[model samples]
Target: MDLELEGKNAIVTGGSKGIGKAIAKELAKEGVNIVIAARNKDLLDATAKELSKETNQRIIPVICDTGNSEAVTKMVNIAIENLNSIDILVNCAARPLVKVLNHFHLKHRMTIFGMI
Candidate 1:
């Protein structure tokens, strides 16, 4: 059960809910500081608070839209600043393009994943 992850830091994209949240929880439980990124500020804040309390590890929440390169870059900078180092990276964000912009059509969904 010991992941030997104590004092490590991690970045979890789309970590506000579902599998990303679960991954963040496990990493936190292993004594890792977690930087969780998602588009919804409210949800990110709530999840960070909950995880920090549960795991007693530092949890940072970052508002990030992975579809944009600038946003992803900013998110990475924020994560590095908050967590100091990125020992683990979990790319679990599953963004529904349909709910995003009205006319912004993505030629490929893998573009976001490529950023990871």
Candidate 2:
């Protein structure tokens, strides 16, 4: 089905694997150029190359640790530079905080939980 997405651009966080990668693939199939962000440069590059070949759409990769605000900002800037403008954003990046919470004090954990 045509999504009327030809020439559009998108940024998909955590797009090197799993759900985010699937979304990026679908968007690329719909004719959308994409900037896929993830922390692993090698994985991101591989995924980008594979998707670009499969969908015949531009797929750029940006290395970004989504838990870091500065990294996220840089990723956005890179995406914009590569794609010209962002028409879609898929925020699929996530951190498994369970292990981290185990190291924290109960009060800190409570604070973090509240934030979550």
Instruction: Summarize candidate 1's per-residue lDDT along 30-81 as a digit string, tens digits.
Output: 9999889999999999999999999999999999888888999998999888
lDDT of each: 0.90, 0.92
Candidate 1 ranges beyond 4 A from true positions: 97-116
lDDT of 2 by residue, 59-88 (tens): 999999988999989988998888889999
lDDT comparing candidate 2 with the true structure: 0.92
Candidate 2: C-alpha RMSD to true structure equals 4.5
| Candidate 2: pairs in clash | none
| Candidate 2 weakest lDDT stretch, 10 residues | 107-116
lDDT of 1 at 28: 95
- Clashes (backbone N, CA, C under 3 Å), per candidate, total 0, 0
